[model samples]
Target: MTRAKVLLIGLIVLALGGVGYLGFEALGVRGFSAGIAAQSLLVLIVVVWTGSYLFRVVTGQMTYMNQRRRYREVYDAKEREDLEARFDALPEEEQQALLQRLGLDGDDVRADS
Candidate 1:
């Protein structure tokens, strides 16, 4: 999820929890809020932090994608160069024989054979 979405969701959950805890404490049911508005501010701080964390993760993923694409281009170029080097080393007669066997000399190699 996006940073904004994460922050919104976290804030919602924190608000619900705080309200539930407050209600519980008032009813003498045992709870965790400490009964202070300032304490609830922690929820906002954490939500903002989590939002920044999520944004960093998204940017890191994009960076990885760009690095991977660059590596692929380099690898493909090397492979093509290697294949050309090997092909060029072959005798002209062998190269012609290979082309003929590949059916490149005729549309109907089987009929000709």
Candidate 2:
């Protein structure tokens, strides 16, 4: 992701590792075993977190995706409005001709309605 996010994750991992190591040592596990235990704890935590995030995404529970979808809908609506305005600006004969060419009834496509 971003550099800042990477740095923050690194810091969080380091902190977790340190806490895990100390916690294991306090429980009478020392040296290499403590280090391994701490590392394993970190791996487990990361795996669980990643799985949770993936589940949310797969279920469409991610807020970012929802926001993007909403933005796209709004953008599409604005584009449609702009196109309709341009079509309305065309001269009456041209508008009628365009509707006939497109097989649309002029009365049904009027902007005033």
**Number of the predicted model whose TM-score against the real structure is largest:** 2
Model 1, span 27-108: residue lDDT tens: 6755343455435655676679789878867877556677897999999999988976775689978766876877564335
Model 2: CA > 4 A from native: 28-33, 56-68, 107-113
User: Which residue segments of model 1 deviate by more than 4 Å?
Assistant: 1-61, 105-113
Estimate, for each residue in 68-98, the C-alpha lDDT of model 2 and write its tens digit.
9899999999998998899889998988899
> What overall lDDT, based on C-alpha atoms, would model 2 receive against the true structure?
0.93
lDDT of 2 at 74: 100
- After best superposition, candidate 1 residue 87: deviation in angstroms? 0.3
Error of 1 at 75 (Å): 0.7
TM-score of each: 0.39, 0.71
